[model samples]
Target chain A: MSGLIKSSLARKVVMALSGLFLVVFLTQHFVINFTSVIAPETFNEWSHFMGYNPLVQFVLQPILIGGVVIHFIMGFVLEIQNKKARGIGYAKYNGGANAPWTSRNMIITGAVVLAFLGLHFYDFWVHEMDYKYVSGLAEDPTRYHEETVEKFAPFWRTVIYVISFVLLSMHLWHGFNSSFQTMGVNNKYSPAIKTITKLFSVIIPLGFIFIALYHHLNPITH
Target chain B: MKLFLKIWRQANANSKGKFTEYTLDGIEGDMSFLEMLDILNEDLIAKSEEPVEFDHDCREGICGMCSLQINGEPHGPDRGVTTCQLHMRRFSDGDTIVIEPFRAKAFPVIKDLIVDRSAFDRIQQAGGYVSVNTSGNTIDANAIPIEKENADNAFNAAACIGCGACVAACKNASAMLFTSAKVSQYALLPQGQVEATDRVMSMVKQMDLEGFGNCTNTGACEVECPKGISLENIARMNREYYAASIKG
Candidate 1:
């Protein structure tokens, strides 16, 4: 609603909800990507299904894209408004004394992650679109495994991917738990929730890094 | 103890400000931060120079009248104490202390080290209250029982003195903590339930209108708050506001 957009708290609720939605998507994406290293056949099968299925390609993909766009746009809106709130900057702001760097520098981490998203889309999404839509190629279920493995074959790409995942880790380190707080989730289980969010922030990014390295090291043999 | 002081000086709200440095000697460690400032003022008065202006009243921590960003921190790097309660002993001899007013667009500087905090009063006026009969027909205090934990939490939330330190401490100059404390103090009690829905809605709207930044859950406000107001108040306010929006 227009009224919701006008309220600062409502805007944050939008950020929290959209961010949580992306987290769900990230979890599923991580699971499927992990299968590429553990079970190539399973990865190919699932990737094929996701790529071709009308429900996923038509419905979920557009929604996922919308979520990403909304999150980033709202993030920028909030950042600009926040900057305006402090009309005059402090001469010496020792922000480190109270808040963590990850928490304070979310925009920096988020920008890095956004840049990585551009590269990630170019590497995979754009390629997939070109393959399926532009070129009108016949379906090759097994091609996914080889194609994914080969993408990481380049040392430079792998290094970039690894660095992006590190930045993503820092972004999630603050954001994942922060979403819950924004949603007003304070209770006896809050401590446990925080622990789980922290763990997920670390483990998921580490998992992605591991997958990237694994493929880079063990590219498909000729 | 001798110290170097860099204090922000401004002629008025419209005038540009700059930090003017002063060196003072023979200050006792037992003297409060304000006492040291008083000594500096005395020297400036004798020299026929403009004295550094700051806000202070009651000289006690409870008034919430004194505000100073000492050494880039609210209340001079002390925990759970206002500027008036901070002693010079916290600093080493020959230390350079930087004193500036709390900076926020919503809190404009009225003079050196005194920003207008009427923005908070406006937020409070928006709805930080509960309607009750005060016409000699008030309900009995013991008529209704409240849970002990809720009472304790409410009391803790009420500890906020509206010092604007949380605003000074937040990187974004967000007033979420201060506003949340006021909301929580009432939202926890039975009396507040009658207008709970309207209270949160209008207060939050007013807060946004005041041009305060949104909360990012950085927890800096909690760390720097002299009253030790918990971040739980903010979480509670978020819950309150969400519930109100849904109810509408």
Candidate 2:
């Protein structure tokens, strides 16, 4: 296991598992929010109901957070290890147009996504969870419904979300495919996986962007 | 052509290193980059001084031994060529050239510009090589008719000489490009598929243990690399790695 631990294959495995887990989380989160555009009232109720779900509130949130932590930690750790194995600069002779921006910028995009997570929690989760708990509205999340609207209502916040989601798209573009490869799944399924990776890279971020823009443009009146 | 060279000088890895200034006069502009260094060394030897210690073998550029940070850029400023391939004609007369050893935690200075690139070899040993030994011929070489595309890509991927310039040119010093190239070579070839997962996982792990920084995707590595290895190989490795993780 130690020998395996020291191998690149294992490190990639860690990256893939963690990354795919987060992708699943992102899709679920997106699907839940798509309800808002269908009908604002339903969206609000759904959001409120999601907050009150006992299993998700207690058991799942920790797991979701843990996924984020592990995905990011393993990525950076593997990157550092790769650097040490090479040198300050990699050999230029063999490298060509083969390198894409995202593969090189995984850390940058990941860092961007990480920072976005902080803002994300500060805006949505803080109000949806932390403030709800502090204001004695834990039993009723709708009391803080205005908080959710007010946060997304800011044009700048919406812009930040768009840019961050763009970064997230870039991250996911490389990460989605990379996750599959890292997990040793690059067989006949590679083509299908690559296609899905590209599609999700665009679709998921677009989903988030649409939600943010709709909220900002149509500022929900309390 | 006349030029000012701020070359790094050190007796050995344990000794203190510093930049020493030297001016060369009447050097032919057509001289290769290494020839310019040779001229400088000749001048120093005449003065009874130690010549700068840098790595070079088969200066024709196939050996992958020559490496230097010329004016803060690896292999000088020329794209798609090694330091040995660079010509003095690229520099104007009286230009100030700053020379430094390749800066990488994994590539510590052995003497002056010579770096210990043995880490790359160790990584290859971790799983870069084909598992099948060259004992009694395992059937004929053509027993397996690998697809032309895969064969070509494998050849392209195998072009990596293990020079450490990508690490130096990269902002974070990540070696994903190099490790990926090695992994993709085997991943693309049928002969390498048997050890593909193990090769990529082990090599990448060894790379991480070496104390280098993470990849930040500035494209500097791609831009400065002499052989022009594609960033696509990195993606291939990522894909290969993803598959390996699930199997394990």
Candidate 3:
């Protein structure tokens, strides 16, 4: 653990592992969200079930939240430590012909996503969880998760979701392959692994964005 | 050949700075990058505008003193060459070259394109040196029979001239390659093995104390490093740290 603490790569491994866990969770989350575009009724039911389900409330909630918390904390910590290890050299030289930009700015990208998540929760999760603080919603207890319909009702909201999803996708594009390398999985299959990871990164975020946009353009509930 | 130059000009670290443009009229393609800068400086002196202040001493590329980020690429469009060694042949006539100081929090802009890179010297002082005192060579040279491979690798690692180019080229401004090279130079040899654990720890600690960025392992430092230090040194440092952390 001391060695791990001292070494920059060890810190990176922690960040990558936690981040990979969150990426997997995000894909699962998009699967649940994408259902909104295909079948509103099923989506609403699923969303409602997710909110009130005892299993999720007791078990999955803590696990998912923990993963995100760990990923975020580890990321910032690694960034801080890495910054300390850096130099102040000037001039040019050879190399690094094949590095993606996102890989370099993961911390900045993460901070953006974290802020977006806070707003996202207030937009949907806070309302759906039916906390008593929502002043106008006390009168209508029956309309809770159905607020997702209202949430994506505006064109700008859909636009925001698309932009946020783009950032998320770009973040994952660098992050997925980085996680593999962090785990000491650098080898012949690294390229194939990176390609597949990028595809998943793009498709999953786009899936969420499509659903958000579809709901805004053609609402089934309204 | 002719190229427009937007050189960074500053009186000193405390002074205000700006980009001052100059067009070299009669430049030969064979003139080196620093030579082109000298021509511009001569013109600047002729105009009585303070000549562009850049850090350069041994134009031979060995001193690591000539540091500049030319045309957004360090050392200007070349792979694996110092600024002084960079030739004007890389640029075409009428090209507008944007010259700027190497950007990093640790590398404070001293004047023009030259920044204070003495932070590297400080980090090295923290533990980069071997502790053994040479009292007219206390030990015989042949006592330490380093494998030919290890000696060659150490030499490669030792070739780093403390130039800040690697830091400038990196987006995050990671200095892993630099730190690792210094660490690996000593870590690979038996003479350096005695204090390896302490050396790695202190150096890495001092590294964090200075504000720099993390290595994403994008390999940019290796690419831009004039010495072409391997990432293997970093791996070696990691192992050394891991072993030390566990033992000590």
**Which candidate's lDDT is highest?**
1
Winner of 2 and 3 under DockQ: 3
Q: Which candidate leads the pack in DockQ?
A: 1
Q: What tens-digit string does per-residue lDDT give for candidate 1 at B55-98?
A: 99988899898998988888879899999999998999999989
TM per prediction: 0.98, 0.74, 0.74
Candidate 2: Cα lDDT at A21: 87
Give the per-residue lDDT digits (tens) of candidate 3, residues B1-248. 87888777777877777777777878888898888888988987999977787888989989989888887666667777898889888888898888888878878888788888887887798789886768876786568899998899888999998898777877667666788789989987888878888888887776666676766666667777887887667656666766777787
> For model 1, what TM-score does chain A reach?
0.98
| Per-residue alpha-carbon lDDT of candidate 1 for residues A60-105, written as tens digits (9 for 90 to 100) | 9999999999999999988999999999999988898999999999
Where in model 3 is the C-alpha error above 4 Å?
A1-17, A31-63, A66-112, A131-156, A179-193, A210-222, B42-53, B109-112, B129-159, B186-193, B216-219, B230-248
Model 2: which docking level applies? Answer: incorrect
Minimum summed lDDT over a 10-residue window in model 3 chain A is located at A86-95
Worst 10 residues of 2 chain B by lDDT: B210-219
Candidate 2 regions exceeding 4 Å error are A1-9, A20-38, A58-60, A75-116, A130-145, A152-222, B25-29, B125-140, B171-223, B231-248
lDDT of each: 0.92, 0.77, 0.75
Quality class of the docking in candidate 1, CAPRI style: medium
Each prediction's DockQ? 0.74, 0.20, 0.22
What are the RMSDs of all candidates, in order?
Answer: 1.1, 5.2, 5.5
**Residue-by-residue lDDT tens digits, candidate 2, A1-222:** 454555555555667777888899899889877776666566677777777788888889888988888888887776666555444343232232435777777888999999999999877787665555777644654543445556787778888899999999999988888665444454668789889989999998999899878777776664
Model 3 alpha-carbon miss at residue B142, Å: 9.4
